[model samples]
Every structure is written in C-alpha cells, then in structure tokens.
Target: MRAHADAFIAYATDPDPRVRRASIEGLGLFLEDAERAVGLLQERLVHESGVAERVLVVQTMADLVLRLPAAAAPARAWFDALADSGSTDADTRLAALAHRARCAPDSIDDRTVPVVIELLRRVTPAPPPEQDPAPDDRRPSRCVHVRPRRRAIRLFPGTSPQHSTTSNATAGSMPPTPLLKALHEALGARFDDRKALLTEQLRSADRATRYDAIDMARRLIASWRGDHTDLAVHSPM
Candidate 1:
C-alpha cells in the first residue's frame, strides 16, 4: 500500500470527478502517516468542487480520528463545526457525528443520545399497497385493504452513517452506519457513561428509539463472538 501512496495522492486531483472522489476514498485507507494523510484530505477539501468529495473528506477524517488517537482535538472540532452548521449537507453533517461517537463517546449525554437516535430514523415515502385493484367494484376483496395514503413515513433504519470507505451515508455499506459502530464501542471499555446513556434509551416508549438501541446491542454482541456476517440491519419498512 505504501508503494502506491504517491499515485493515490496525485489522483486525488484527477480531472474526472469520479476518479477524484474514488482516490479520496482510497487515500483514507492508507493510514501509514496519519498527519500527512489528514493534511492531504484538508487540501482536497478545498480543491474539490462536488459534495461527494467533501463528504468523503469529512468521513475520512472521522475514520482517521477513530483509528489514530493523535488525530483528535482538531478533527473533532471540525466535525462539531460542520455538525452545527446550518449550511452543511446531510451526508457531511451526519458524518460529523461519527467523530463524536468514536473519538468522544464520553461527551455523549442525554441530549446527545436523542440527536444520535434521530440519525437512525429514515424518512421515506410510504409505499403503495401490495394488493392491486379488485376486478369488480371492490366486492369485499381481502386484497382490497385500505392502502396508506401516499405520504412519507418514518423508518428506524439507523439514520445516515457509513463505513469509512463508503462515500454515501444515506446509501452506505452493508455494515451498520457509523452511529451503530459508535454504539458498539459504548458497550465496553472506555465509554461507560455512553453505555449508561444508551441503556436508558432501550426503555423509550418510542419504537424507533428502542429499535435502534436494540440494534446497537445486537451489533455489540455480534462483534464479541467474532461474527461480522450478521451485522446487517434489515429495514422494517
């Protein structure tokens, strides 16, 4: 990987937007030199014209902060800034939360849990009825049930989080989002307070809150048993 570091750096500014974003995503994986990698990401953030690269930069920075203890403070500050900013795009804004979850889980309190839980809720338009129109004037057909009006419904699909390499938060990796991963960290080791906060979330009357909390626990236990294959959260839409 080190041998191709220079190529990846150069490709970060490729003329093709797709190549540029792909290279940016690839650069985050090369963790040989943390500071240098971060510097390059910052530079790319300025030069990039599209939201995709910017989102990549933000997500990569979060991954860096998570892996390299030295990448905190500055990176965390940037995440907080973006998260708080009204102008921030949805993916970058959500990616910002990853820094809080992974690098500063202890900072998460009751106020923070609601925001994180909010991330798990997916706002999707309700689907049309699975049943088709009845043959006659709807003569008491079992299939002719009351279809939900065409309106948006909230799904607790664990709001927009992504794997480090995934550029799109809304449409990310098979693994649970960064939020889920952060909750995984909370279950043991350094985040006792975070664990307590999440434990409280499990009892919330709101089904979305409880579902996300349970999913977090599910991911935590799966990781403990060395079971990565079962971490995918199927959306109950």
Candidate 2:
C-alpha cells in the first residue's frame, strides 16, 4: 500500500494524461490524512496544466473535505482563497466555486453567487467550418464485384460464446472527473434535484456542458450509496 501510494504521488505529474488522472484519483487513499493529501494536491494544482487535471485536483480536495471535514480544514481554506483570488485562472475559480457549493454550501453567499452563475452561463465556442472536399473526392471509385466462396465452419461441440468475461464488468463504468467525484461524495444520497439538472445538461448541444454532465453523472453514481470502495477500485490509475 505504501509503495503504491508513493508511486501515485510521483506519477501525479506524469506526462501521460491517463497516468496523471490515475495518480490524482489514487490520492484519495490518503483521506485518513486529509491535510497531507490536500497539501500535496494543492501543490500539484499550482504546477498542473490542462483543464482536466486542474478540475480533478479541485474535485479531489472537495471530496476530502466532504469525507473528512475535521481533517480537511486546510483544504477548505485553500478553496476559499482560490475562489476569491483575482489572479487564479477562470477555470480553476469555477472549479473552486463548484467544490464549495457541493461540500460546504453555507460558505457560498453573495460574493460567490454571481461567479457561479456566470460560470454556468459560459459556453464552448463553435468549431471552425470544414473545407469542401476536392473534386476527385466527390464520388466513390468503381470496382469489379466478386462473390467469395464460403469456407467450412468447424464446430466445437462443448464450447459456447465466452459470455462471462471481464469486459461485461466494465461495460457500464464511466469514471468521473475529479470535480464530479467530489460532487458525488459531497452530495451523498440526496442528489435527485442535482441529478435532474445534470441530466438536462447532458442533453445540451454544447460540448463543454455535455462533458461536465457526463463527468458529474459518473461520480454521482459511483458514490450513490456513500460507499467509496468501487470508486477507489476504479480510481484514475
């Protein structure tokens, strides 16, 4: 356990996106030492680039707070400052607001309300128009048709399809981003209203909205029963 935790801490900054994500999720194992985990995550946030990584770190901190409030005081303070800081990037601030809303609603008021409202209103930009295909690309090429002869099939009398496989176990799994995971943990079992809202967002035409909705749903279901066992098993790694 110690070795794995150490490896995850090192891989937090790994160049590969999958590795980084797995490492971030693995940090949840340190929930028993919230201060240490939160502090490490905060440090990673400062150095982390990319939207996904930032979102995950913020969500993980929120999850820590929700699961271990007494031990997550430092994490709460960190979010408070991040949300209020003018120099922080817009996305990070948005994540901070979302985390606070999920884990500590009372902390949100007039000052943060407008910010959250604005973030929810933000939209992804439309993609640029594609160039028309060249004239030669307009039609399919003509080819001679030939029917191939069928080969004899061999029957394994005792064998059927391998229906019982690990593939089936993973079919319904959708790993949530860090932010979504935190929201799920924080919301606990009372997420009907939030679930409905996220479902609406899932149907949105905007790519960003859809992405957020999917991530949120993944986490919501993962922590639905307030059991972190499965979530831990499928952590980013």
Provide the global lDDT of candidate 2 against the true structure: 0.58
| lDDT: worst 10-residue window of model 2 | 163-172
- Candidate models: Cα lDDT each: 0.55, 0.58
Candidate 2 on 1-237: residue-level lDDT in tens? 644677778888788976887778667655366667887888989887765677678877776776777645787788889888888766677678778878786664545545643444332223356799999899987887888443222211111334111110011121222333344445454555445445544544444345445556676666565443433343232
Clash number for each model: 3, 2
Candidate 2 error regions (>4 Å): 1-3, 126-237
Q: Each candidate: RMSD to true structure? A: 8.6, 13.4
Candidate 1 runs further than 4 Å off: 31-33, 46-54, 118-137, 140-179, 183-237
Q: Which candidate is the best by lDDT?
A: 2
